[model samples]
Target: MPDSTPRAPVLQMPQVVVDMKLPQIRELATQLRFAPEEGRIWMDERRMVLVHSDTFADLREELLASLGYEMTRGLLTRIYFAAGQRDAASVLKRLGPGASLKEVLNTGGRMHALQGYLLPEHVGRGLAAGDLRSDDYYGEALWKDSLEDEAHVARHGVGQHAVCWNAVGYCSGYLSYCAQRTIVVREVECRASGGNHCKIVAQPAAQWDNVEEDLRFLLPQPVGRRARIVAPVADGGPTTALAQSAVTDSRDDDRAAPRSLAETAFVGASTAFSVLRHKIDRVAPTQATVLLLGESGVGKSLIARQVHRRSQRAQAQLIEVNCAAIPEALVESELFGVERGAFSGASQARAGRFEAAHGGTLFLDEVATLSPTTQGKLLRVLQSGALERLGSNQTRVTDVRVIAATNEDLKQAVRQGRFREDLYFRLNVFPVVVPPLRERRDDIPLLVQALLQRFAPLHGRGHVGITSRALQALIHHDWPGNIRELENVIERAVIMLHEGEMLDLQHLSYADDTLSTPSYFGLDDTGQLMINTDYDFGASQSPASTSAASPAALDMNRLADDLLRQGPGQLAAMERALVRSAVRQAGGNITRAAALLGLSRAQTEYRYRKQQSAPG
Candidate 1:
């Protein structure tokens, strides 16, 4: 049964305030840089491109004809939404500490106007004055001469429905980023819809009456089945909303109550993350087993959780197991339950992960490490949904969806006979590759903000901020260890900072200036990666004297004389001393010390051991 009664609109526009009167907004024009010599325009570190209104209108018409109206709107909305998120990250980084929430939100509006999208004027009480998480909180704005609506109406006749989809999406994205929650913005009145001016309303997504209907244009079409919004009963715990299907549904009251901000939300707005998100949305509804392939510490566990959260089984248990952490002999007992007296230490019957995860999901990380015997049992359970307990002939049945993840190549393992081919196919029903952090450098700023916000509160450090130079260094680094490495670096930097102190290059472990590969790469105003060529490599020379005049500053003749003054065995002693010094400087890490000394880890260890055993 649907609620057929009509409800009043959530917002009504009040007297509009002039944009110039707003005192909270930062001047965005200063951040805008132009370099005609290099033929580039930049807004902070982001590259900006200029597209004519007619050209955009042409593309919109083509997309509307080809993919249809709803999809075109959704596609354009998502693009601007990502743009808004990137802008939020830039503002957060540049604002430093002690910035009010009002200032941030106002700056976002000003930024939208600066980009030639719309001249936004705040109507009704502004968003910053109220608590964003409150149920009654609502925001309204008037867009004077919206570029989207003006171009849309010029290309095609005035439409019945509001046509400013990009403006709605950009507002939603910008507000959501600043709030750290999902905010939905709708163009209630548009010039294309015969309105004198465009009027937009915004509120948290969960507060909307028909959230599913509002979000339909943003996601891809589902393969099968109508969309359903499942709102779990929360016992003082977290809750998530089910995203609507790609196609629209005519049903009423398809509502979900999504929580404010959660730590589990996907934080990155980069294209790589967007593609990965689309793949997850497509596969989450199905009961097919998902194989998450990625390098270690690439957030596979988080992806597994995301899949479960978005699936029909969100309310059920999600059992996670690190296959590599468990010993080979105990792997079977852990995955499948053991009956009483099943083994020497078996005292009582117990349910395995599959039983625990009945009507839910089972995330098996490092799944390639399972032995042949265990792999065979896993195959049987996956195929027939039945398993036999250890030391027992009785069979048990459990309904569970499995999502397996691994850094190793399963196909290569199958070819080498390390993993079963049958089991591999069973789990590989939907493979999603999570890209490494280095491939998505645009996400670093957002990730940094999220990490800092999460870490600062835990350590009781109020308002810990980072320098722009330090953040730039982070964006340039090659994160071989992926997100995990980034987390370690940020956490270490946070720990080094004093209470209320800002994080600088000195606090970063990897950003030390003395290192050979210093964190000196930065993006110029033209958005080009520029190396800090001005860094002085000549350290041993006197500060007041030039290297040309001080030829003996690093003279090998003096070193040879010193060696000659010592005994014949001085060379070996010097070599041992250098290895020891490198190891000490590397904080006892033999691998890093080996890198410092330009030797293999084994070679470094051998030399270190020989020197240690030979007398002081």
Candidate 2:
């Protein structure tokens, strides 16, 4: 069932005069530089006047002319009985006869009372009476953080720096009056919840500002003890009923969040997986260049395929080009194609990656390694959608989508002049960063099962599954080479597995020696000394030693042997200990620990969190 809810209203203040008898109050407001046109005063339920307050000085003269009042500056407290609303007498009377003038000036409590008057029953009846327009009831809630600072000055006099809260309150109140509805103004601190710095919320004033000037023209001239009803006025205004119905229909169309491609296509429910899939969907349909960034062996090519599969041009072929694998001199011809007899190597006409991918996509792997000349040609294709074949003057126009991948930082390459800025911007229109296997560690078991199923059938061997302990080890290991490394390890393990056996840690190919060593302490996997700690020379050690073994030597040989036989759980524990020690020494500085261990900050942090969350 579709939901139905009334939206809030937008409000606008009108320019009008404020009747003031006291010259001193007017003088004070003028000295404060408040403009009169921005605020109005109500006198004895019969007269309405405008006053100039310095805060809105731009509208001061206009406000005076509108009210047919002389533009003069003076104190106004004694002269102005009430500001805003032709029905002020009844509003003030409801506040009680003995209410102090100060109580009336206290806007917060009065504002709350006004909200109470907007009860659903009252609003419904008002709508029925044609006195209240439904269009005046709905508007988007806008919050400005700076309102509190402004309010503080309005409530309390601005000392050195003049703050205008009166102007704010007057403007907000007049807007509500024009809308014939209550408006709530909330002054909220910007940084209170570690969100925005400040926010001022104005609510339920619906389109008030949009039609306020028209409302002012339609307002009846003041008469003694009663608000004179003027003739119905229309500034060629559209019917409010239509607006109300549209708002109602729009509410039905609202959704909490958008559905992802994985959710809609494969019925996948994992949020992380769905987010990645959604990113692919958004980037697929457009010709905008996409940069796919992920660690090595993280199925970047698989993601590229998914993008191509979901794209409109999926009927066309998707060509893959590994930039790093191609010779620097031949990279341009490979991408842009070459004419027959263009060069010594070009014996026949050959369509390049771009031509082959016409009406489809060209996937460039390791794009950061492209030669500067290749980068320039790629930029031209992206900019002009036209390419020149090698040794040919004719330009071929190709409608091809581009998807580039790199594990390295292209931005850094651009800064170093290794990558062209124009090409980088063109190709980096949308960037999809594929998370490493370690990030989506929960998927490790699924991947392992799939790999085992595939490899077992290929080898003509019985199907095998990983034991819980072995799986734990696989999840904990820092997959430097990512999925490719995992696949190799699983394949090797499957090859070595015996019949009727669930694979255990011993069956796995990874051992203590295979793991990277800790360079900071000069420690290997088995606590063997790879560096001499006896060197007292205080100098920055080589980056290579950051992952080496500690200099201390003990039962190092036995420890290494034990680690080799033990499962990944044991190795993970040792790694955690090393990380914790480094973090403690660095005073919880993860970056320093990462530098000490020759690991990236993200890698160090991930490992730390994994250890922290592991079951005791």
Candidate 3:
């Protein structure tokens, strides 16, 4: 029995305008500037580090020549797939959320050409008038301009359909994000296969006739943890192919987060995560049923989709069934199709989740909550890939790879006689355990960076990162709710900040509410902003009451009185506060912080030293 969830509303695209010409490639390339400044590289407001083409090309050649076609292609696909997602997000952000479909498609395609990937030629008429590219004008990719194709041909002879696997994955990922649906692209013609140039077509998943076969190439293959440069062959045989060797820092290509993570709010990389990641890689390409064991908020559904992406069903939809969310009475009719007049309210024959997920993956989240009767029906479908409509005896054959996830221990349920033992064993052919966030602490930094990148663009409050001290505070806490909890915290922090203020976390609330412990960013002695977590703050402790009991409140009043008496900071008090706050926010670093205040390091140090000497 499959759980039923309401489907997402399909997005309607804009009606196409005649002869639409987007921003030319030349103008877009001009905006793509590379310059290093302020101890970091800058591409406009975004922080970026520069890389030369030869350096990248050299690495690409080595990876392909040494790792063989399968290993290299899978590795590169994952890397660029992530890059495509981030690029699409940035493009959409720049274009504004409400831009018309034609604007997004035309500009996105032009950006692809400008980025030196493939030259996308307009296919059919123009932008299709829906969430999907219509049959009239599906997207097309021309191969003559692909940098990757040229690089491959220069070293390895053209031998196959299309050697540009990375670009195909990249285009597919970018367009999919734009369409708000899963779109797959594949090479139909290629220069590598002795054609004049490489050419490919893109379509929404429903439009693909042979999606099951195409899904295999999209699976996340296990890539090397690191890569090293094998010096180019002195014999001039284009001997730069990457062979496995000592580990190097070549894996920093993580854009946003790894695309293999799939539609998740967060991702992490740590030894604790390796077990599940390895299991996903090994089982994704196979037909074996997988049971994901994890705690709530551990991202089980996203991991399930990742397995689908890497399996033979990438071209099909990943239908999710939230068992606990569905009504108990409707479970039967929802899992199997319902015929017209099957029940009092059955108006027409309708397909269920099983029918919808034909030739794809069906993810049953929280499968442990399933009732005993539903469990038996699910077992029947698992044993024989055939099912019947609720009111009809006619049977239908379906091909779906089932992946079930649960936060509960199914073994305990079976022993308690609440769950069937046979069904449990059938679903447990391959089990992958997902570790909680507390166990994978090493991945916090990467997760934070990735989360900030996503949240910053939406709220415009993450131009600068939090202080290391704040980061330490985040890492030290044990996350009971896991990644979902972390996401909420980051969002709250973003909302609290104003534009142009760097994120300097001063307070943290492990609990859902921080009402009693209101966050106040105060500076401490030694010119450093200190995080005062233990302070009690609320309406009860408001300033009106504090005048009677708090020395700090008394001091502030006295300073105000002094300012009023002597007239507007006659004591030079506010200036001192500003200096101290600057130093504190800089994490007690003197010189760098002094610069933030537009003062020379030596001058500020000299004035502070003189003040100390003159003190009584």
Candidate 4:
């Protein structure tokens, strides 16, 4: 059985005696570049010097030279050294009878000057390896050896021991030592491996700033600090003429504010909106192409307009193009003007969007939808700042600011080969991402009020106020369609409401009903589709029974097998069936159809479009 008893604590020793070995002492003397005759060793309670008689004067001179002071009477002392296994017993044997051991030990072990030595090759190798394990091991060994010496001193009740080193330690030991409360000695580094030579660093126990200043003085001067200043100002107040000139300069700056893009831009108080505003203001004046990114209905076009309005070419026309709305066949001709005889429909010459907006700004909305050929032309225009009209050899030089906006992730599109990488980067010089309305819901009330005022007159209704309950509901509803959806809702409510009427729950439409229920639609345990009919679809069949037959009941594992058995139109028929069932169960209400399918109105509409686009 192993012993479970705790080990006894060992006494810690000072490092002075451990560091006084012949080899280490000699190394220190060599580092200091001192002659052998100039130094002496003492061992009798550290009071008696072991020096040759001829070198006594040399020893005294060396001591004075190293310490920057002369050694006088009482400076040297005798110390006791033990002769046996135990340090206490050895000290008693070394000190002769009638000699006061305590007095000798108390006055021994004092040196005016101290130095540390290290090899550069070892340090460099350790650093190059990226790990300082070897260096740390060396430092720990030195510290442990010194500690043993300290223990020996305590056992004998002799003089105290001190350990010192140069800035170069086994690794970071020097820095660790400096972090401690007590500093034992001065550290120095010998940069002999390189052009740097041995240098002394005297680190005192206190006043670290002075040590830093000393290091600064030793290092070579930096170029920046060494550079001379050509201009100097006298300490005096500016003359009256100079003050008047400064006032005139201030007026001129004010007059020049209108010419700057940033000066005319709007500032928002909200952090996200303010950052967007600042980014727009900063990038507006530059000719660099700008990309505006955001979700649908986030006012990306408004930001693009701001970019064009504040730009240097604001005086020229601002041409707008919607890539998603334009037919793929006409996109190329629409971008680069078509010649009269270029195609059957071209009876007259017409300038393209880019040509019309030359020397101004060209705003491309839904830019991700641009065809590959048009994208190539756009890339050329960005790279060369020149474009050739269709069926024309003449290349027209354009000074147009290109600001493109997209609801889709263009980088992802680029990776998918749906967009050109070179064109994406060219137009992405400055990207301004507009925050979704849901993210900045605090602006919802302000936006609603503004829209209410704008649309009330058109709807032939006086100002309609929203009830507190209605406003709270609006805030809670996740406006997936964003501000555009909010505008449409307010407009519909205003048309239905009488003048001075407050909008209530009847006027509001909430989108969170389907999102709030987890069982409505999600994957089940077997990776099969699951649906809950408890949601208000007004279905004739009970929710529990209907849910069992819904898509959620279909096994996805068998989907491939099922697809092989069915025709190509089977998937389309399934989707149509689902939509028809949802709409019928909701009594043909599209809003309830959206809720039954757990989709937003816009998403439902998009799905409808996809169904129409599907092949028969």
Candidate of highest lDDT: 1
Runs of candidate 3 with Cα error greater than 4 angstroms are 1-266, 461-464, 507-511, 514-616
Candidate ranking (lDDT, best to worst): 1, 3, 2, 4
Give one digit per residue, the lDDT tens place, for model 1 in 287-361.
989999999978999889888988999999999999999988878888998999999978999888888999999
Using all chains and alpha carbons, the TM-scores for the candidates as numbered come to 0.52, 0.41, 0.47, 0.41
Clashes in candidate 2: how many? Answer: 63
When summed lDDT is taken over every stretch of 10 residues in candidate 3, the lowest stretch is 241-250
For model 1, which pairs clash? none
Worst 10-residue lDDT window, candidate 1: 244-253
List lDDT for all candidates, in order. Answer: 0.69, 0.50, 0.61, 0.48
Candidate 4 local lDDT, 1-616, one digit each (tens):
1112432211111122333333322212221111123132212111123344335445434544676331211122100001101122212222323435322221111111121122122122222222122222211111111221122233333322221111222112222211222111222422221112222222322435454332232212322211111011111111232121121121222332222222211222234665676787688888888888899987777677777777788788888899899999898889888888888889888888888887898999999999888899999988887888787788888777788999999999999999999998898888888998767654565466456656777788864666533554464456888777777778777887866677764565534422222232211222222342122121222444443443233233234334544557777667787887887788867788899999998887677667669787
lDDT of 2 by residue, 253-357 (tens): 122133232211221212455567678778877766888988888878878877887788879998999999999889988998899999998999888889988
Candidate 4 shows a clash count of: 22
* Model 1 bad stretches (over 4 Å): 1-45, 49-93, 96-265, 510-616
Least accurate 10 contiguous residues by lDDT in model 4: 77-86
**Any runs in candidate 4 off by more than 4 Å, and if so which?**
1-269, 510-616
Per-residue lDDT of 489 in model 3: 79
